[model samples]
Structure formats: structure tokens, C-alpha cells
Target: MTKTVRIALQGLTCDGCVSSLTTAFMTNPAVESVTVTREPSQATVTYNSAETTPEALCSLVDDAGFEGTVSES
Candidate 1:
């Protein structure tokens, strides 16, 4: 199954920030797409549930040097 998760990213202040965020998600084999907004500091990630979970996705962002957290909203 596929799932879409929205996460909040803190400390993004430039376009290059988006580049790293994009790279973080794309590195995961199960991630289908990643869309992040700077003003709102949010990312909508579509991924395969069987291969990856929302928590895992958030970890990716943190690993890439960003402060991130998954939210119900």
C-alpha cells in the first residue's frame, strides 16, 4: 500500500535546502515523491508503506541535517 505523510521541517532558509530535502527522500527506494514548501516548512511525501513508514521518512530528513517531525495534520 501507499501512504502520504506530511512533516514539518525546521531551519530551511534557502533553495539549496530544498535540494537536500529532495535528495534525502529520493535516496529511499520506497519514496515515490517529495514536495516541500519553504514558507510553511512542510513536506508532503508519498511512499510505499510496505517499504517505508512515516517515522522513517522523518528520520531521513534529520539524517540530512534538518530538524523534522511527523505530524497528524
Candidate 2:
């Protein structure tokens, strides 16, 4: 089964930052889709729990150059 993760991001200054995270998350095998909004500083991430976890998802965001934290919604 798949699981959805919602993340609140910090330090997203521009579209380029959102795009970078979008690219990184989309390339992940476990992630089915992603939506990031810079104005609200949030991202809705859908992924397979079997292949990944919230921690890993946040790591991708961190690697992409933004601060990320997960929350339930």
C-alpha cells in the first residue's frame, strides 16, 4: 500500500528551490507524486511506505537545499 506524507518546508525563497525539491522527490522510486507550494511553504508527498519513510523523504528535501519537517494531515 501507499502512504501520503505532508511536509512543511522552510527557507524556500523562489520557484527554483521548489523545482529542485520536485525533481529530487519525483526521481525517488517510492514517491508516486509531489506538490510543493512556496508561498505556503508546504509539500504534499505520496509514496510507498514499503520502499521509503518520512525521514527519508525529508532527507531528500534537505539534500535539495531546503529545510523540511513532516506532519500528519
Candidate 3:
């Protein structure tokens, strides 16, 4: 099954941050797509639930030197 999550992010300053995070998320084969916004400081990620979890996705963002929390809505 595929699941999509919206992650609230902090410490993003530029397009480079977006590109870097997008690349990081894509490194996981389970990730289907990633869309990041600078103004809102959030990322929408679609991935295979069987292969990954929302927590794991947040970890990816954190590992990229940013703070990420799974948005409830």
C-alpha cells in the first residue's frame, strides 16, 4: 500500500535545501515522490507503506540537518 505524508520542516532557507532533501528522500526506493515548499516549510512525501513509515520519513529529513515532524492534517 502507498501512503502520503505531510511533514512540517524547520531550517530550510533556499532551493538548495529543497533539492538536497528531495534527493535524500529519493534515495529510498520506497519513496514515490517528494514535494517541498520553502514558504510553508513543509514536505509532502508519497511512499510505499509496506517499505517505510512516517517516522522513517521524518528521520530522513532530520538526517539531512533539518527538523521534521509528521503533520496531523
Candidate 4:
């Protein structure tokens, strides 16, 4: 199934952060799309649930040198 995850982010300082994160998420085969917004410090990601999980997605953000937590909203 396809799932959409909204993640609250920390440590994003500029447009470059958005670019880097967007690139990172786009590299994942499981990720269908990614929309990162800096003003609100969040990312809306769509991915295949069978191929990845919300935890793994947060880990990916961490690996990219940022912090992320699954957002309820």
C-alpha cells in the first residue's frame, strides 16, 4: 500500500537543506514523491509501505544529518 508521512524536521538552515533532503528522499526507490517546506520545517513523503516504513524514513533524514520525527498532522 502507498502511505503518506508528514515529518517534522530540525536543523534545516537554508534552501540547500531542502535541496539536500529532497535529493536524499528522491534516491529511495520506495519514495514516490517528496515535498519539503522550510518555513514549517516539515516534509510530506509518499512511499510504498511494503518497501519502507516511517521509522526508516526518519532514519534516512538522520543519516542526512538532520533530525526527523513522524508528525501526527
TM-score for each of the candidates: 0.94, 0.93, 0.97, 0.98
Q: Write down the TM-score for model 3.
A: 0.97
* 1-73: candidate 3 lDDT, tens digit per residue: 9989999999999999999998999999999999999989999999999999999999999999999999988
Q: What ordering of candidates by lDDT runs from best to worst?
A: 4, 3, 1, 2
In the range 1-73, model 4's lDDT, one tens digit per residue, is 9999999999999999999999999989999999999989999999999999999999999999999999997
Give residue 51's error in model 4 in angstroms: 0.3
Query: Distance from true position, residue 45, model 3, in Å?
Result: 0.4
Candidate 3 clashing pairs, residues 3+ apart or interchain: none
Which ranges of candidate 3 are over 4 A from the true structure?
Answer: none
**Residue 12 in model 4: lDDT:** 96
- State the displacement of the C-alpha of residue 12, model 2, in Å, after optimal TM-score superposition: 0.8
Candidate 4 clashing pairs? none
Q: What is the C-alpha lDDT of each candidate?
A: 0.90, 0.90, 0.95, 0.97
Compared with the true structure, what per-residue lDDT tens digits does model 1 show for residues 37-73?
8978889999999998999998899898898899677
Rank order by TM-score, top first?
4, 3, 1, 2
